[model samples]
Target: MVEQVSVFLENTSGRLAELTRVLGNAGINMHALMVADTSEFGVVRIICDSPSKAKAVLDEAGFGASIANVLAVEVPDRPGGLADLLETLGDEGMNVEYAYCFVRPQGSSAVDVFRVDDERASSVLQAAGFRVLGASELYSS
Candidate 1:
């Protein structure tokens, strides 16, 4: 499982800019991000090089931020790659509550960030021949 930083922000102009500024000032590099919003507020999920540090800085900057454990599964870049992964997980009875994707620097494969209720999903996927990434793999310098 990888640590993801989730921040709550108001749905106003420059809110995202302010959040990014805070993270930037802390020298935290955001590797991936996803935003879900309603009329009044938004939930920003961020995968950074240092999750703990990111959360601390965001809290100090007056942003509501916390860490979540999510699976970073590497899928092939070709067609049907994501579908196949989801199908396998479904067959194994794993439910994906939410997910997001990001391309790795190598470009050979894309990493899918999956929020599953079961922590064992990572080991299960690895045993099923999928490459479940770790913090070092996802945040390598």
Candidate 2:
């Protein structure tokens, strides 16, 4: 499992930049990010080098921030690699709530973030032959 930082922001100009600026100034590097939104507001989910610190910085800066446990999995950078993982999870009756992908710079693989229905989805994925990364693995990568 990994800690995913989520920042709630208004759907207005400079809000995204402000969020990034705060994290940047605090030296928190984003490993992955995804935004889910409607017309009024957006939820920016991010995996960073320092999740707790990032949450604190965002909160102090008046941004609504929270954290959740998510899974970071490594998939081969090939066709159907991701599909295979999803299929395996499906076979286990696990449903993915949300997901995003990022290429692994130092390896021949891609790292993906996922919000799954089951709390033990990570362990299940690992047992099914997938590489589920720890928070440290993502931060270091």
Candidate 3:
């Protein structure tokens, strides 16, 4: 499971810059990130090389943070690609709490990291036509 650091920030200007600067100054590398915002606050979820370090830095900076385990599944970069996977999970009675997708380059495939309610990720992956890639696998290739 790939661990993600979720940071809560005020929905104002310079908040993201400050957070990134703090992490950058602390020598933390953010590999992937997703930001969802409400009217008052924004949730920035990140996958970094050192999740604990990132959380510590955020805490020192007075930002509310949390760490969660997510499943990084590689999916085909095409229409209905995600639908196929979702159908499989639905068939097996696995609910997807939330998910985010990111594409590599023009020549490579895309990857979607899903945050599931339970640790039924293995079963979901086996049932779906997707490959559950580990963090090492994500870094290696």
Q: What is the lDDT of residue 46 in candidate 2?
A: 94
RMSD of each: 1.3, 1.5, 2.4
TM-score of each: 0.94, 0.95, 0.86
**Could you give candidate 2's per-residue lDDT for residues 62-121 as a string of tens digits?**
999999998899999999999999998899888999999998679999998999979778
Task: Locate the minimum summed-lDDT window of 10 residues in model 1.
Answer: 132-141
The sequence of per-residue lDDT tens digits that candidate 3 reaches over residues 73-136 is 8788889888888887777777888889877565366778887787776666766557887777
Error of 2 at 94 (Å): 1.4
Q: Rate the local accuracy (lDDT) of all candidates.
A: 0.90, 0.89, 0.81
Better of 1 and 2 by lDDT: 1
Q: Residue by residue across 60-131, what tens digits does model 1's lDDT show?
A: 989989999999999999999999889888988989999999897877899999999986788788888999
Q: In model 3, what is the error at residue 86, expressed in angstroms?
A: 1.3
Task: Give the Å shift of residue 11 in candidate 2.
Answer: 0.8
